[model samples]
Target: MSDPHYDREAEKYESPIPSREHILSFIQEKPRSKRQLFDLLALADEQKKAFERRLRAMVRDKQLSCNKSGVYRPFSNRGLLTGTVIANPKGFGFVALDKGGKDLRLTSQQMKLVFHGDKIRVRLLNKKLDAEIVEVLETVKTLVGRLHLDGKKPYVVVDDRRIKHNIEITELIDGCLDNQVVVVEMLSSPTIDSDAKGKISSIIGNYLDEGVEVDSAIYRHQIPAVFSEKALKESAQLPTKVIPKDKKNRIDITKLELITIDGEDSRDFDDAVYAEPTKNGWKLLVAIADVSHYVKEGSELDSESHERGNSVYFPHRVVPMLPEAISNGLCSLNPKVERLSMVCEMYIDPLGELLDYKFYSAVMLSHARLTYTQVNEMLEDKKSPLRMTFSNVTDNIDFLYGLYKTLRISRQKRGVMDFDRIESQILFDNKGKIKDIVASSRNDAHRLIEECMLMANQAAAKFLQKNNEDFLYRSHPKPTAEKVELTQKFLTAIGLTLEGGIEPESRNFAKVLKQAKGRDDENIIKTVVLRTMKQATYTPVNEGHFGLAFEDYAHFTSPIRRYPDLLVHRAIKRVLNTTSREPSGKMIEFGTHLSMTERRADDASRDVEQWLKCEYMRDKVGENFHGVISGVAGFGLFVELSEVYVEGLVSIRDLKDDYFIFDDVHHQLKGQRGGKIYRLGDMIKVKVASVNLDDRKIDFIPDFG
Candidate 1:
């Protein structure tokens, strides 16, 4: 009564199908057509539909792939490579090679099937360096974005410009409005033919609300913003003050006239210093808050602290690694408070060479909490108000100043590279809008405290090394050959040369920097040299610090914020207790993770600052300003405004007069017909043409008239 084919298909849909393993095993041996596979398995007509469903599932899982000939095989049999997709705002992407080769470029059409940060398997197209998305192993599951409305439909646009797709919202949370910043939970992964679906998880706030810029950055970077319930409970139950028993084994240094010097806005005072001149040289005592005593290993608080790795400092707020109860209350070296500390007592010669040092737990009281400005005033005039107020520690402050001078000379002799870069600080209004971006000044007081901390850190590193204790060291490797060559070419283009052989030492770079000082392109030269240097990272293997020119260097201060410092403290304590245990293998993994978290925080902070800068410039469109060419690229020249410290791109299209060609070797963009060149460090006038808040970009055009 029914058609034979329809009846057969219906019967196949109702029958039992072969196991996925069997199907995979058969296909993995050799590529097989769908009909051939069905026949090989001896599947009945009634099982064909179920077999097809399983095949589709396998393909979706990336375990199987279908060829143009309708043949299927295990993905492993194909010569596809696995990598993570880094999407770009321009609709294209790159597959970061998993095995450390050149990245495979992907066209916009291929990028449409995947999102940024997706783990994917890609196949090279025709033996070229370009790849096509073959399968997506994983998709971005959560995102922070702004909510949008399209007629009757609502969607979320991810703030990360690299992701070019809008997530269609299936459900909206209460209180969510159009254009509000919200966190979204993806409901389904994207496929080649469909977009990702999501539901609003939490509404952050209005787009332009106070603190929303920082909040958005926090969420976008996946920074842990809140302490766990267990950590909070532990913090709440902790003792607010140090007790008598807590000071049992500690050497009492409460009478040493120690003082804490910090920035005006610093909250958590971590280290206090006291120095006195000796017949031989000087005696320096550096006391740091013993945060490990309160937050023990394997505790809930410690777990959370380790996960956070380090505190993140934004403009007006901090995402602390430890609870405030510990970081700011119990462990802070507040003035007049008796706190537990780990003290580094060092004897240095007049030449700033360390003769000897020892570490011990101690009870110390900071006599005064002085700011850099106050200390600078006191140093310049002994009759300053702050000097009179804290007269008890005036002699110690003066001795510290003398010791700092000695250390400065020693550092110069040691060839440490000190780049005189101007750092900017944002002044925020009550509503958190940027009032001004001013250059942060460095004074004598800042240098004094820095030298003191450096001596202490060096002492800690040497102590751990001599005792053969396991510890994390801050290591900076020399520049790579490729980078060195590029730097040399750039230097030559600027009418300079890098001395000290092929592998130039830090002193050579220092010499070049000194030579470039007061020059018209001083900042540019410094920036280029800095770019040639490699980034410093924490490692268990000591490779020495190239920038500091120290044979051994580790971060031993600020344990309240940095995890590496905490580990150093713990290791020192273990050595003090005469224990001989090596650090666990897990410590290496933790070091790597901590380094990544540090970079993540830096990136997140920069993102927030850029967003704020864009908001600040929104109202200044069409205003003229003087700027320096900070970057040169094929598309445009990046100019940093001198008045606001805001950087914007001057697109080549807006150059107007001539076509520009990028010169990568010289880091310049030159015009074809006009012969005009835009190079790094060249000062020029520009007008703010546009500000795109959605993309967090500012655009500028040359003001030739």
Candidate 2:
């Protein structure tokens, strides 16, 4: 018999918990594709019985579908697809194809000849868009995974859950111990079927090594740790520095009290913002390091950066977009360096209204390199010896702070919703252990920097707007009816009320949030309300950003790490400096693609980050921690621990004695017997139970008082 777990979900889709009937029928019913068989049997076993009877009846009635081959399929007779497999541990997965709406559902066993993360050919058993994966054309010969010895056999547990099964280590090449993640090479492939066999090729490192994140990020991102020969050859020839006379002119370095403010450990500084109170209002100079000036479009360096898409910054290390020579040296806006930059000069008034904004190309000298901690301390009147280091900007910092206040007021008036949540920064030890988790707050300096970046991005949006041009503008669609309705119900259950529904837009939501300020569940409210809004994405068709309440917005800062920003920088330069140059229609289209690609890279990066963070928190298992309910699910509640800022699943199964039902409308998990409710923004205590680093799942036992 097939594995019990496998057979359960593979059955007909009749169980409250999906079972294996559908998968088996799909595999057994050769005439019909898996999805078709599943959907057919899923309809009613009574009518689906007797294959000839069901087919004859369906054909006679013309209520069902089939092909001329008499082999029923989803799309066509074969219902096959070539795509990438995205796996979840639930034994089912989705296949992402290159074509539009290309995702199809496949079961664990139906994943024919493909391994997780492998590009493969799949055949749909049924005419369903989501069918079981029927084939995998190519398996990743080299993979990164954890080594776990089960009895006599050792298995490389894949970090990527998309791979349905653990790869057995036919040979432990380096005396690799259990629970250590290692690299593997595929030694066997299913000749006529889907399963892939592989061996542990090399021991990468211990699971929680300090450098593991960088290694994982590089592999997951497909980033080459070393530069290619072609890329290296190109970088070697590149000018180390712009010639003394090559610059347009010696731009004022001491005149403007420009500063770079970022995280404490930041190595690459991409932007500097300086704003001085002007006669009419304020003159804000947003200078972004000119990366395009060196990484010329279509060059080998450009091609490399494009392939990398963006720099991946892990806690311990960074996978740079360009080689270190460019990212950390020439292109970095390090203080005292005369780096090329594209500046957005904006004049604004006390009312937070922009009088005018213009994009300009220039070379800039960063007067000081500051960190958020330093700026925040100065703002809070904490003792700082380095206060003298930024003497020139001491008074200007005051001015910048005042401008951000005005911008905040202005932004509020414009209905922008600022979802300010406490983000946790994980500190690491030299050995790659999580030293401590620190709660990060948005301080005056952060706001000042953020306001400046927003201004530049909004200006980019307006630039194209005024030109009446079709360009890639980052947009977020309004919430859906179902999500909005669900959110409304949740708000009412928590005794919170909204004046208007989802139609009220960002300002309205901001007002509600402002009203909920300092409340215990404020973060929870913000998170869920955000869930109701559409995710922001790059598109030529502008729908505007509902979250920022911006009719126009584009990323015009941080070109060092983000491709979209570089593209936006190019567009801005073309508009500001190049009088005869026009952005080709093709160029705009490419930007859109790059923007989408960049978004995917960001998502992947975030997933990897979240996974590693969870892994780091594993050592603290069984320890009780304070957390807030971040989300509500049918099976459990999501608790984001206050101390670590790491989120874990608090399974309802372990929440006291009462049977719990998901009160989704309340955004909480409630006990049916006691009427105990755990809402989205509720404060709760939890003890960590199981930390499945393999699943990136942290199971918490909720403290139900």
Candidate 3:
């Protein structure tokens, strides 16, 4: 019964069963009468009932259903079944089925009839899990955002970043000019490539004004900026602040030496930290905003948060996860006020290895709120007054700093691939217009807190793993063999070598990165090493994290912005309570959904940021900047500008001196006659020739004289 050999699955097809063996033999068998065959292989009384009961339950739950009817019956009530469109980036789409063979794949061309997120029907053509798009039932019409011209044709660049294509805009609302953003309605009448015709309905304005802030807020998170009358009414009716009556075993901890360290402009203070040297080691406390407590499950507020997924922060604006009533007020861990929190109590020894940890529902006091800039300044300056403010806690501060350094070193020794990726921030004026682009350097304060959060996350994962609990883990698998080989070649070309032999551990990559410090190509090497690694994703499987070099890891902090952390909180609470009931199948399902949602949110955020940055640079078409060759593609070479820290393409035509042919596998372009090759990480200067704000792309011409 435990092992289902070939014969068992054969029997399953004869008898109606759910999830038969996904093999050829089971699918290749001859037809049988549906009811009679099932009736023939029936088991003894209770066992028969149990099997039928499970099958019925699965069917009733809409998780499974019968597929094809037999030849014993002439009219086999089966043609094709279909549902919503799910897709992948490589341009393949799936049509959900119910006559229930398998989810069908709709080729990119077939999907040209119905865009992603459209509900459509499909016909079976090849096999189970394969089909052709038959019809589209519904298309999502109205999209929110700006109108930008593509070449000479204009396109409605929707605020929803999940939309794979930019719909062309035909009708325009007056008072909106080129590069002047506006939200538009997509006319139901189909247009270019399965997309709908669209027209500008409203102006969101230029990127810098107050109205633009609201627009940025909506554009970043895809959340409606203007609240519905009903929702706003509910907010207006609710109490402004938490009264003392809401207190549970309340004791004020607002006067303790707890401090918040974040960016200078961060308004939503979700976490506050405090630490001091203990007897055996050090005592570290991370008090995070108790958002889950305030936003109860199944409430309107809860539904809103779930839909938004998380707060979206653009370069000059923010879209909050929770409304101002909660995120910026009662639940915020601000100084001089009592705020409830869930705390992680950590113990670490002198060697910087985190020894043990526990989580608790606690209230913490913060004496001073600190910013990263201020902390960095104080650490560098001997006579800074901020050090004196921590006079009573000076030893604690020193110990914590020393511990952070030790942990960082320990992390490196364990082969943790330290990726110091540079991010560019566009400075905005009071009017919200982009004034300049600046690259923000990662400092010790940022790394210190990152290390702290990592410790907590790792400890949480270890706890769940050791307890044999059903939990979603943050995992990054080993890179593909092909990717590793490519990485080796790139590193060798860039004057760096992966140290621990041909087959090197992640630690070898880390060592190369460490040694590349102060080199001109440091960023290039770091970027290459990063690209060679696998992406971190969440799963129920404990695959381990390759980048952090941990056997197990999870996201336990940042409950405010991450749903997985909230689930972790619930899991920890369940364990603490030691209840009779454990997490059901729904718990795992929810974890999967949340993980997927988190990734979706990330993609949307990144897409919007790119669009905004590209839009900001659109007006400065002729500007020049020194740059490096970030990538070489078939079409052209990608130049990363040093001044703006933005990347654009230099089309192959621009390389006029020599006819270049793309050397595909090696990631370079060869001058066919001259034998001069342009490759990845090659430094050069470029002049921005054109910008397509709608496509969020810029064109460059290589200044090769």
> What lDDT does candidate 2 reach at residue 200?
70
Q: What is the lDDT of residue 623 in candidate 1?
A: 97
Per-residue lDDT of candidate 1, residues 1-705 (tens digit): 122344444566555566666677778789999999877878778778878878878877878876534578777537878999988889998999777688988888678778887898887754568776677778877888989875578988889888887888999978988899999998887655577899998999998999988888888888998999999999999899999999998899999999999998999999999999999999999999999898898999989998898999998889999998898899999999899999999999999999999999999999999999999999998778877788888999999999999999889999888786887889998877899988886899998999999999999999998888777888899998888888888888888888866689998888888888889999899988999999889888888889889998999999999999998999999999998477567767877888988998998898888888898999999999999999899999999999888899999999988999999879999999999999999999999999998798999999998
User: Which candidate achieves the best lDDT against the true structure?
Assistant: 1
Order of candidate numbers by TM-score, starting with the best? 1, 2, 3
The local distance difference test score of each candidate is 0.88, 0.72, 0.68
TM-score of each: 0.90, 0.83, 0.77
State the TM-score for model 3: 0.77
Error of 1 at 256 (Å): 0.7
Model 3, C-alpha of 684: deviation from truth (Å): 0.8
Minimum summed lDDT over a 10-residue window in model 3 is located at 68-77
Off by over 4 Å in 2: 1-83, 120-141, 148-155, 168-180, 187-194, 199-202, 249-254, 382-387, 465-471, 499-502, 577-619, 703-705
